[model samples]
Target: MRLTSGVFMFLLLVLSSVCVAETYNMETQFIAPIKLPINLVPLVNEHLDSPFERYGCAASLRQSLEASFVRLSPTAEPSILVKPAESCLCGVHTCSFWILRQCGATYCFAGHLHAHSIEINQATLLNDYYGLTGLPGGATSSEATHFLFDGKSYVEEKIEPKQIK
Candidate 1:
């Protein structure tokens, strides 16, 4: 049977949306020594001109976390909190935030400045209770944006990190 383009598109969309794997929202604890990967790239907005530069911070953090996880256990699934902290900001230089991850339940930490890491009020889950998948928002191929999560999910949550300009 020949299906019209509009109908076919609608059906495909519905099926795809329905096929999304169900994720659990149950309260879970992080395994010991929650590791946060250190970002090796500069966090200046001007330096984010290329893909490598753009995703360097997040990708480096993920790679570091993965490496630590591999060393600890290749089979164990652990929850992680990736906190991006501003490390340096000068007159002309853009701000740079160092990324750190910890293993445990979410805890309140204060931001710092002057030769120290300032933890931002952002806690991103790395993996789930099961060793299956990482966080839902992966990097995208946008212009200069390194990481862009699902807009729909962010919209639903109504919480998007704002630039500290």
Candidate 2:
């Protein structure tokens, strides 16, 4: 009976490791402060409110992404692979992707500011970035919810990632 119990315990340990899901580090960048179009200025003025109001674009984006991530991944512990900096401007858009790769991230949450809106998208990191497709095991749509700032709060929208195949 003792030998049987030991075998069962060993099997449980091995199975538990296999069942554990991979944890991803979350990183967000505002890219830059948005310049709204003339027509949309009024609409955004009312809705681009953020908790880190005093912080600049980069911090604000990080805060917003962190908040949303917590809501989406209630059980997962939060981790930030990228160190906080006063700025996060990579000259070219593609340069930012290189930064993420260097940081050793399995996932990244990014927010970009546009003429009339703030867009948020999450992507997986592997050989390349994949949007909603090729997610790690056990990932769900909630974890990859594409959102847009609607002048009041983030609203779920279907925004496709550029690098997604």
lDDT (Cα, tens digit) per residue for candidate 2, span 1-165 = 999999999999998876554322223433332222243222322333333322435534343122112112223333122222222322111111101111233433332221111111233222232221112223232233433333222334566666867
| Candidate 1 regions with alpha-carbon error over 4 angstroms | 1-76, 89-165
C-alpha local distance difference test of each model: 0.27, 0.30
Q: Estimate, for each residue in 1-165, the C-alpha lDDT of model 1 and write its tens digit.
A: 356888999999998875554231111212333344333222222333345434443444333222112111223332233222211111122222222122244312111111111121122322211111212221431121122123111101233567798
The numbered model that scores best in lDDT is 2
Mind sharing the TM-score for model 1?
Answer: 0.17
For model 2, the stretches where C-alpha displacement exceeds 4 angstroms are: 24-80, 83-99, 103-165
Q: Which pairs, if any, clash in model 1?
A: 34-102, 34-103, 36-101, 112-118
